[model samples]
Target chain A: MKLSKYNLGVIILILIASQAILAFLLFLGQPYFQLQGNSFFALLLLFFILELAALLIYEKINTARIKTSFGRFIKQIKLGNYESEESHIIQKYDFVNITDIQIELSELVGRIQADYNEQKRYIENVSHELMTPIAIIRGKLELLIQSEKITKSDFKLISQIMTKLDRLTRVNQSLVLLSKIDYNHYQDKATISFNDILDETLNLFEDQIRIDELVIRKDIKEDLRFNMNENLAYILIKNMIKNAVIHNIEKGYLRIKKLEDANGIQIINSGAVIHASTDQLFKRFQVEGGYQDSIGLGLSIISKICEVSGIKLTYTHHEGVHTVTIQF
Target chain B: MKILIVEDDLEILRTVLKYFDSFGYVLEKAKNYQDGLAKVNEFVYDCVILDLNLPDGDGIDLLAKIKQKNKSTGVIILSANSSIETKVAGLEIGADDYLTKPFHLSELNARVKSVVRRNKYEGDNAVRFNEIIIDTASQEVTVHSKKIKLTKKEYELLLYLVINKNRVLTKQSISEHIWGDFIDRTDSYDFIYSHLKNLRKKIMEKDGLDYIQTIYGIGYKFAEREIE
Candidate 1:
């Protein structure tokens, strides 16, 4: 049992009231029998002390029980267990003052959950429904282009239309990927070797690297490995390497190395200096440099993967040099 | 070659059928799961282009049934869900290949041809277009009985072109075919141009006629040139 300041004050008040009642009783009994005042007051004082001690212990135990029940309610809320049949909030938090707040909180959580589920279903349905039409249009265009009736001007129009269609397809796919990550779809994890993935990604962009005459450098003494979903790790690394190559200038350099002081890796590249704040770059559709090919979801995807994987990610650009560091 | 496409979307099915009509294949269509299952039970096709989101049944089960009927028949699962898990699951159940929705018809055609070629028992692996012969098994290209070296990207480009020969292949399709849909870049067209140039120069070095025709403002077409 613990005594807080408030409990202490209440105990003092109770003791004073009891002492008053005892003094009055002694005063009233003065006429009934001849008694030693000192002895009688001493006996009364002893009884009063005992009663005060009992009250303090009772108050402390009561307060402790309330604190624990309240703590359990908070824990349940934090874990999103609002719909539990035997929830602490419903069963134990039925005290006079707290019951109102608990009821309101549960209602709020229910509404939010419903809204979230609806939004998720809508996103899924829209993306799925849009794909069939896009496929049909693309197929029709392909068939149209094969016809001999299409003139030079018509071919140009078809080409432009095809480019836009490709863009639309990419945007839809990226959005679906983002929502999937948001919903914890990729929960499977495994030990992934950074060295192996980096090698493969670099090879994938080998043609572009050579075409741009970009210099490649690697500084790693040992293979870097981390545990993550293998598919996400591949995408994360591939996106990083792709950004490095795509945004790089002619004859620029790209360097990938293990962090000297941390359990992570860093990718440094020479590229055009950006004017937009770094925070905006990680947002969807925030394309810097106005590159026509960029859909600008790369950074967002990288950030999303990092967020879900519990990895520390930092992006810094100094002058013409851009650096991205991922700390596991 | 014989093929069956099981898709619920009528418009998509019609489009696919029309595009494949030029190939002279014995094409069949089933608009729902019941029809698809019935057709699969009745006929042993060389390939089945299956859409996973059937109206009445799961496509994976149909894929199993198709393979059970004939082990040599190739099944390519088409789906709108591009998740890695779905791809892995389909492939694990003996699916020959998987393609996501909004796919390129040319890419689909190329995959269908490749799948059929791979499942063929007699092992006829050579892809011959005029004097240009591509041995798919060895990844070798020969023109007029003379060997010519080609880079990996160049070789894939040549094969994709030769497989969908005479069709105006878009730069986007070509890029996606070789680099995949991951490398999203506008300048990939330039890479295509440079690679095609090198390919043209290499083929001409062996005194082979240039069959690659550039459709201005669009893409390339590999066909026998019509005399003007």
Candidate 2:
């Protein structure tokens, strides 16, 4: 049986008291007490030393066993292995009186998992339900635009409505994507070449780049490859490049280069001066510069993908220049 | 052309049916799984638009049944689930294409046409609108029998416009068609404008009539010029 520290201390105290009482009884039987060169007293002292050593050794072994089992429990929890059999935990640590706490923890984990699953399901359902209505509205508008009786003013109004509808679709899709990321839907990891994704993203926005008259520069001596979900890598890089292009000034410049001292890439773009705090920009619905078309979710998506992929992201703006770095 | 849409949502089904009514196709719809299965057994449609989230049955199973009934019939899975895994699964189960929910009708119409064309054993591969012709097999565009060199985006834009000929294609639909919802800027309409300009210029250089019409404040249309 394992003994807690307090219980062991109490038992040791009781043993000492009993030993003292026995010595007193011995003294009571004797005419006088002697300490020097007393064989009986020496025998008592040797017995006490052996008993203490045995107790210490027993406590040491008990503590080590408890430590190992507790460590395993914590590691299991950390790894999200909450579905492991609670009976196993109880049976393994029954002697240490931790079975009750283990049972309680397992119950809590079960409750949390159920709640998380429910929340994820709710998100998916809400998004799915919203899609049909959006689709209907868009289709009706398309039908309206095809009518010959509609005047120019009517078309203008319809265009305005269509713009807002497009924005709604984009916002909804982004939210769905964000929730998916939160639920760890993108857990697949593979080695992805950052340079290839970067080039492809640049090509996608080539028209915008040319329209803005932005000069592009690539300073990578070698390709930077990192392990992450390929989908997320594409999204992250696309959003980054899109941000750089859309927010850039006329005739501005964009520079992409690998970090010299770190295994990551940095993007620097010339843009108008910004007064918003960097922290505010990373948040959802925090639109800077009053760009009307900005849905304000790009940065958050990038940050979210980086967070799930275990990459470090940093953003800074100074004197009309913006720099975003991703460290893997 | 003959097509069937199997969807549980009545409003979406009605809207799709109404939109495709002008296309003059024999369009049919089923509100549940059993109705859809029976229809598949009864008649052969050129294409079947299947919604994965059916009230009565799984869409993937229905897709397999359709393929079993006719290997040549095209099936396009329309779903609200835009996850990559679902898309890959649908395609793996003999689906011709997969379109996510809240999609443009014009895009859907284009997909239906493209799928029907591909499913035919001896189909005409060229998509022609007046003097301009697009050879789908080679992705080549020729105006008045003179081939014109166009960029990738230009080629796609021309084909999208020609396939939905005489219809007012919205800027949003066109952008989504070419860019696939990744580029989310209103300024992308500007990219559309620039590409269309180049396409028009190239066709005009080949002495092709100017069939592209800009409906002010709405979008562009490819059709015959009305004698005004």
TM-score of each model, paired residue for residue: 0.83, 0.86
True interface contacts retained by model 1:
0.77
Q: How high is the CA lDDT of each candidate model? A: 0.88, 0.88
lDDT of 1 by residue, B48-107 (tens): 999999989999999999999999999999998787888999999999999999998899
Q: DockQ of each candidate's interface versus the true one?
A: 0.57, 0.61
Give per-residue CA lDDT, model 1, range A214-320, as digits (tens): 99998987999889999899999999999999999999999999999988999999999888888999999999986778999999999999998889999999887
lDDT of 2 at A57: 80
Q: Per-residue alpha-carbon lDDT of model 2 for A192-239, expressed as tens digits?
A: 999889888898889889898999999988989999999999999999
Model 1 stretches with alpha carbons more than 4 Å out: A1-113
Please report the candidate that would top DockQ against the real structure: 2
**Worst-scoring 10-residue span by lDDT in model 1 chain A:** A80-89
